[model samples]
Target: MIISTKLTAERLEEIKNHPTSYDENSPKLTKAQIARLRPAHEAYWNVTPVKKTISIKIDADILAALQSGGKGYQTKINSILRKAITTGDY
Candidate 1:
């Protein structure tokens, strides 16, 4: 990610004129914050790889049910399956 921080003299003057627009001493993250974040970060990295797709068939009623919601039916199906796997409900 590329971050650009260019502060012109005019911009600095505007900030000084409106200091209240910004939050001061926003809560700092500590070691406890790092500990709390580790599990979710690790879980994200532990995801299994998706295999390549192949031709398949399903009941016409089920296909219609998925397609009735609107566009991107295939993506929606994948999202449903992913949520089920994540929640151990599949």
Candidate 2:
């Protein structure tokens, strides 16, 4: 099971006090470096949510169209659903 944690100000301060070895090598990025960054096609969540496998039925035509778009189609669908929920567009 995946566990998610929120970084509250108090928790962040606690983490700041005890630096990990990995943190030592990673310096803060400059504006130029930050600007140069590009997003990954998918799998960009900092802490990936737990995914549950379930069977979902879709219309043949709709399913074919999504599949034809190629790999990451399911991720695309999830994006669509998330947007719909946020905007109440569905």
Candidate 3:
């Protein structure tokens, strides 16, 4: 659904220099129009993407320890695993 429009170098420069000026004073959308906007088409757009979900089981003690690291423990674990993989530490 992408559209391509050819722009001259001058037009490009104009855009770069004045991006926000294009519609600076435009009327804001009414609540109904805002509500009609589509939700994200890509599921990945709403996901962290650092790792995929799986159902692997770990020791209860180890799981608790990782979770103790707090709110983003799962993401932290994935980052740790990524580093370990790159370094062949596991």
TM-score of each: 0.44, 0.45, 0.42
lDDT, model 3: 0.72
Ranking of predictions according to TM-score? 2, 1, 3
Clashes of 3: 0
User: Which digits, one per residue and each the tens of the lDDT, describe model 3 over residues 50-90?
Assistant: 54678888899988999998899888878898777645467
Let me know the TM-score candidate 1 reaches against the reference structure. Answer: 0.44
lDDT head-to-head 1 vs 2, winner: 2
Indicate the TM-score of model 2.
0.45
lDDT per residue, candidate 2, 1-63, as tens digits?
Answer: 743377888768777798555455787776567656656853564657688888999999988
Best by TM-score: 2
**Clash pairs, model 1 backbone:** none
The candidate 1 region of ten consecutive residues with least summed lDDT is 19-28
Candidates sorted by lDDT, descending order? 2, 1, 3
Cα deviation at 86, candidate 3, in Å, is 0.3
Model 3 ranges with Cα > 4 A deviation: 1-50
lDDT of each: 0.74, 0.76, 0.72
